[model samples]
Every structure is written in C-alpha cells, then in structure tokens.
Target: MGIVWRAARLVERRPQTATASSLVFVVPGWPGHLPGQHVDVRLTADDGYQTVRSYSLAAPGDGDRIELGVQVVPDGEVSPYLAHDLPPGSDVEVRGPLGSWFVRRPDQTEPVLLVAGGSGVVPLAAMIRARSRTGTHSPFYLLYSARSPDEVWYRDHLANPDPQVDVRIVYTQQAPPGSTRRPGRVTRGDLDKQAAQLQPDSPVYVCGPTGFVESVSNLLIDMGWNPAAIRTERFG
Candidate 1:
C-alpha cells in the first residue's frame, strides 16, 4: 500500500542546541516506527510552492506521537521553517517512518556500536533510546564527532552516565576549555579502543555526512569488522 501523507500538528518544541530543536507532533493513527527510521516532511508556501525533506526520528515513542530533531540550514528550504518559523499548533504534511536498511530492531541482542557526526546523531539516538526502552543489556557504545561541544546535540541525554551505553565524544574543530582530548577527527586509535569493547559479531551503525560515514565505515572494515554487520546512513 502507498504511504499516505498525513497532517501532523506540532504539539511541542524543545531546543537542543543553539541551532537545533526537537519538534514533537501529534499524529493520529501513526504507524509505529523502528529506531533509525526517518520521515519525509513537506511544507507549502503561500504561493503554492512546496519542498520536501527527510529527517530521522530522534527517539522511540508510542505510535501516536512523533519526534524529529531539526538543524537549521543557512539556506535550506524546509528546515529553516521547521527550526525557526513554525509555530506551535501549526500543521505540516509528513509521510513515513520509512527505510528498513538502517533500522535497529527490538529483538537485536548482540553488542551494538554506533558512530555519528554532527546532526547525524539523530537516528543513532533513536537506537540508543530503543535499546534502553526495551531493557536490553547488550553492550552499546557511541563514538560521536562534532565540530565543538556546543554543536553536540542531546548533550544532557547522552550524559546520562549509563554503564550499559558508553558515549565518547570527539571534537574535530574545537574543544571546550580545559578539555583533555586534543581537537581532531575520529582516528584509527579511537576506533581500536572502542572496537575492543565489542564482540566480533557486534552490529555497527554509522551515520553522518557522506565523507564522514565513508571514512568511519572504511576504518571499521579495516579493523576486521564484518562488512555485512555494518549499516550506514549518510546525510549532508
């Protein structure tokens, strides 16, 4: 069956960072979504021009309420509206909860590794939330890279200090004052240390800009992780 576009009302908005915000919608009859799935959003202008974009679900939720974390793009057609202009109670068209290749199912019990860059952490965050929500103790580790500490999304949520989910932050451009780690991209050494924590069969999910995803995925392959066990999703 074709997925129908439904009007979702914006029920709440929470700021995650200076440029990113989490938008929650009340969608009646929303089909449940697995962690790492995304939704296609469409916005129409007054003159009838419309634009569509895809954003990952940021958290696991009941089928009725959907959440998306939007990062404002300087010249983007849709994201600007979503991040800055749209008011509460506004209605927008959404279709999806889509894509299968990148999902993390509830039944997955093996160790899991997630790597993210910039705003690409969206879906990976969903996977973490799903793991916690399902009460799975299978080890999960996240190595997230961003330009600086302020640009990191969901900082507090990631700071939960849960022993079951380990999150390591890497700053590519700048680090906060007094930070111990030098500012740089994710290196082979970083991956090696984290990879040692996982079983050989652990499922690895990498999401980020095309270049970042490619670099990390290649590193994992070089580290002898199975290509079949690695899943990736790339964004701008």
Candidate 2:
C-alpha cells in the first residue's frame, strides 16, 4: 500500500539554487522520515491520467514536518506540473519514507565529507542539519557545486554557519568576473585536496546528478578510500 500524507499547508517556497525550489510542507500528524528517503508524489490530470514522481526528503527526523527541495527539470511534465499548478494550500498526496538504501548514523569522530552538485545537495543538506540539531561533534566538510552563484542551493544557510558545520561553494559554469573557478566538474585533485584537510578514516557522502555522483565516486576510489567509506545518492 502507498504511504499517504496530506499537505497541512505550505510553510515556505523559495528558489534555492538555479532553477530549483525548496518547499516546506507541514502535514498534520505527519510521521517523521529519515534523511535520504524519498516520497512518491502522485498527480492526476483532469482526465485521470495519473503520474507519480519520487523526490528525496531533505528534512531530518525531527518529529516535525517534511521538506523537499525540488529542482524542476526543464521539459519534465510532473515537476513542471507541481511547480506551476500546485498552490500553497493545495494538498499534495505523497507515499514514502521509502528506500532503505540511504545514509544513516556514522561515527561522530569520523570526519564527514559531503559533496553536492546542483539539487543533489538536498540529502547532504539534510545530514548536515541533523548533525547540528542533535549536537553531534562530527566535523563536516561540504563541497557544493552549481552552475553559477545564483544556482547554489542553500547558499544563505551554508554561509550562516552553525558551530558544527563547514561548507564551500564551487561553480563550474560561470564564476564571478574577477574570480577563479576551478574549470569543469569536481576532479580527483579537488577530492584529494579536500580529503587531505580532514582526519584519516573520514566517511564521505556524495550527492548530485548521476554524472557527478559517478565521477566523484570513481575519484574517491582512486584516492585510496574504500568503496564502503563513501555513500552516494543521485537524481536526474
């Protein structure tokens, strides 16, 4: 059976990164969800042709509402429908906290490397939030990439730091006029340099588009990190 939830109300909807919207939903009596699990969003047309899309939940298990940072795909039917048609008070039907394959508790002493590309930063963001909220002492290193400054999701949240988090922003497409942006995607060199900054035996979490995930995963492999030491989640 599908897990069902009612949209209690829209708390906030704002542009996170370029072409991405971060939405907070308050479902009354909502069951909390894990960091990386996603919910299937069900939408039906007036003619009854139904469509379901799965999106990862970016909120932690706080016993509160759920949050989703949706990066609307260009020419995508379901995302566009939700972005444009769904209003604040409109109740959305969702089935989740699905997918057992996700990141969970790790050693508080093991340094964490969180890498996010575009909207793939959603899950990593959730982990960061959870760690801070629970007062875990894990050292977090975030290397987030976006097309440009305007597209970097959670820029404000990252810049305004809690004592428990450390974050960096990388841009591949357009850097500020006078600034130097490392050309292309996150490279082996980038991963190596960042990994060197941390203590040995650190755990890594990688999220982003499939290409980003694959490339970073391979780079981590080449850097002498065990496949088990790195965790990843991907989106189109």
Candidate 3:
C-alpha cells in the first residue's frame, strides 16, 4: 500500500553466494509488508541521472528494516552497485511494498508449495521467514533449483531442519561430491515427490526466470495441480 518514495539507508550486507548478496535497508516509517512484495530502488548520480530497478523483499516485516536480495547482472546499470559497492551507511530511494498477486499472508493456514529457481528464491524465503516469525504451523514444501551448490542462497538456513517444512535442493550445472541427484534442471520426479505432500486445494507459489517458471508451472498442471491455485512471478 505504500507508494511514496522513502529514504532507505543500508544497514547491513551479507553475502548470499559468490555473485549475490542480501541488503538490509532501514526505511523509516515503512508500512509493514507481506511475504512476496517487491520495491523499486532508485539511485541518483551526481549529474542528476537516475535509474530504478525492482527487487523482491528478502524477508517479512521487521519494524522499519527491509531486506532485499540482489543478483549481479554483469552489464546492467543498477544491480552491480547494490550487490557490491553501496556501503553500510549509504542511502537510496525506495518506492514499494508493491505487487499483491504472489503474496501469502501470515494467517493463511493451507499447505504451501514453493518452487524457486536461481536468485528468485528471495521472496519465497520471505514467505518462509514470515511463517516462522508469526509462529504459524502450516505445512511447507520447498523445491529449490540452482546452477550449483555454491550459488544456493540462504544455504545454511534452508538446510537447517525445520519440522514444518520440507526442502529439496537440485542443481542444474554442477552437483557436489556425494550428491545423489545428477546435474540437470528439475525433472518431473522432483515435482512428483512434492506434489504428494500437498492437498488438492493447497496453494503453490513459483518464482524464477520466465522459462523455468513456465516449465514448472506446466509440469505442475499436468501432475494435477490446479492452475488457479498456483501463483507465479517470473524475471528475465
């Protein structure tokens, strides 16, 4: 609901992977946000040139602090700065808590199926965090895909055992030593395993690049998931 441009100062930065990082911004007077909303980050240069890019929130509401996960685009304008150069006290302008289609509220008690690819895991991670922060007991199934073991964001937290959530990590480019799954994109069998854990009316959220989202969404539909019950947000 917040559409005004607010001052956001970087409070912390944590490396998520070799090329991605999580940026914590303290936006004073930020109206709390839901699980999957995104914000527009605007940067103004000394010459009065400005550029804006949208980034998904990496966590749920926590007072005035908002977290964003950024993946560097080698030739892009904004991502590189957000991921690497912006110092801890530097300020930027943010306009958000935008998009409602992919969000999940804290009180929704149905089983949840989350499918994330590459850096798209940011917002879904917010949903996971929200479920924990609010102490809800809804069942969670997360099927995450990355290019390699090293590119997995929030690695330790996702790997940590949680009684209410089931997590399966699949690699597309390189599989680590002793890994049971081969290096490839998520196959039908992956969704098959998760599909069994959810009920007929349970909601599914999918986020990734356009192709990955399209592929997974179609597979879920073929495997009997209701298209209307599946929410998707795609990038690139």
Per-model lDDT: 0.89, 0.76, 0.92
Which tens-of-lDDT digit does each residue in 182-223 have in candidate 2? 546888766666788774446788888899999998888888
| Candidate 3 TM-score, C-alpha based | 0.98
Give the per-residue lDDT of model 3 (tens digit) for 66-151.
Answer: 99999999898889889999999999999989998999986698889999999989999999988888788878999999999899
By lDDT, is 1 or 2 better?
Answer: 1
Best by TM-score: 3
List, residue by residue over 100-187, the lDDT tens digit for candidate 1: 9999988888888999999999999998888888889888899999999889998888988468898999899999899888999888
Q: Where does model 2 exceed 4 Å of error?
A: 1-9, 106-109, 199-201
The list of candidate 1 runs beyond 4 A from truth reads none
Worst 10 residues of 2 by lDDT: 1-10
lDDT of 3 at 109: 83
C-alpha displacement of 125 in model 2, angstroms? 0.6
Best by lDDT: 3
TM-score of each: 0.96, 0.89, 0.98
Candidate 2 TM-score versus the reference: 0.89
Clashing pairs in 2: 18-151
Give the worst 10-residue stretch by lDDT in candidate 1.
192-201
Report the candidate with higher TM-score, 1 versus 2.
1
